[model samples]
Target: MIAYVGDFGLARFLSDVPQTSLVGVKGSTGYIALEYAMGAKASTQGDVYSYGILLLEMIPGKGPTDDMFKDNLSLRHFAKLSLPKRVMDIVDPVLLEEAKVSQGSGNHTNTRKRMHACLISMVRIGVLCSANSPRDRMEMKDVVTEMHAIKDLYLGVRIHQDEQVMSQLSGEDPSYLSYY
Candidate 1:
C-alpha cells in the first residue's frame, strides 16, 4: 500500500494537478522547510528539502516528529550525526534483518561492508538534499542520479554473488556464468 507523508489537509483539498505554489505555507510541520516557515513562497527547493527528509526517515524508520527530535535535535541532525560512523546504529532493524537474511552464510564480511557503504551514500544524499540553504541542496536530477547509482552498486554486487553461489552449486566455473 502507498502511504503519503505530507499535509493531509492540502492533499485532501488540492486537485491532483502539480502545484508550483500554494496560498500559504501548508506542509506537515517537520517536513516543511525553514524558508517556508519564514514566509518564503513554496518552491521546488522547498520540496527537495522535504523529499530529503523522507529519504532520511525511510532508511532509519524514524519520523521527524518523533519524540527523540526534541530540544534542537531533528531528523536531519540525527542522520548527519550518524554519518559514516554510526550508520548501523540509526538504520532500521528491519533493513538489517533483511540484509542478514539475503546475505545467507557466505561472505558475510563483504556483504556487510557493501551494505554499510550503500547506507552511508544514501544518508549523505539525504543530508545534501536537505541542506539549510536552498543553494546548497542537491538538485532533484542529481538526487535521482545518485539514488540510481547506489541501487546499481548494491544490486551489481548481489547479482555477482548470486552467480557465484549458483556456479558453486552446479559445479561450474563462476566466470563462465551468463550475465544475460
Candidate 2:
C-alpha cells in the first residue's frame, strides 16, 4: 500500500478546506512524464508512469535529477533498454552489499543457484518498471503480483534456512545449515 505524497491535484485538495477537490493540472515535475506535462489528460497510464518513476526512486534512494540524465542517460531510458546489469552499477551500495550476502555463502549449489536467480529476477523487474514508454511498462497489478512472488520465494528460502538452524541447535543434524 505504497502512497505518493506530493503535489498531485488530489493532495492539494486534501490540504484545502472541508473536502475540497482540486481541479487543474496535477503532478510533480521531473517525476511526471512528458505527456502529462504537456497537458495530456491524467489517467491510469499517467499513474503508471509515475509509479515507474517511484520505483526508480526506491531502488536508487534518490529522486531523478537533471544531472543524473545527461543526454538520454536517464534511468527511464537505461531501464527501457533492459540494461539491468548496468543499472546494477548504480544501485545503492548498501543494497548491493546486502544482495551479495544473500546470494553468497552456500555450499548447496542448488540454493546458491536459486538465490542468484531471484536476484536477477528482482533486477529485471526494477528495470521493466522503469521503462521509458508507459505502454512498455508493466501494469501496477502485474508489478504487485511479481513483487509478491519474489518476496514469497525469498521468504521460503529464509524459512528453510531457519528450520535447518533449529535442527542443528537440537543436534539433529549439526551440518544442516552449514553453508561452507
* Regions more than 4 Å wrong, model 2: 1-23, 80-84, 98-119, 157-180
- List the pairs of residues colliding in candidate 2: none
lDDT, candidate 2, 57-103, per-residue tens:
65555566646677767765544343323445545677656766876
**Candidate 1 clashing pairs?**
none
**Model 2 lDDT at residue 153:** 55
Could you say which candidate leads in TM-score? Answer: 1
Candidate 1 residue 128 Cα shift, in angstroms, is 1.0
* Cα RMSD, model 1: 9.9
TM-score of the candidate numbered 2? Answer: 0.58
Give residue 78's lDDT in candidate 1 (0 to 100): 92
Residue by residue across 1-180, what tens digits does model 1's lDDT show? 122567423333444445555454577767877775555555677778888888898888888898999999999989988865687789989878987887678777666766776787788778877889888888889889868866765565456554444333222442311210
TM-score of 1: 0.74
Worst 10 residues of 1 by lDDT: 171-180
Q: Estimate each model's TM-score.
A: 0.74, 0.58
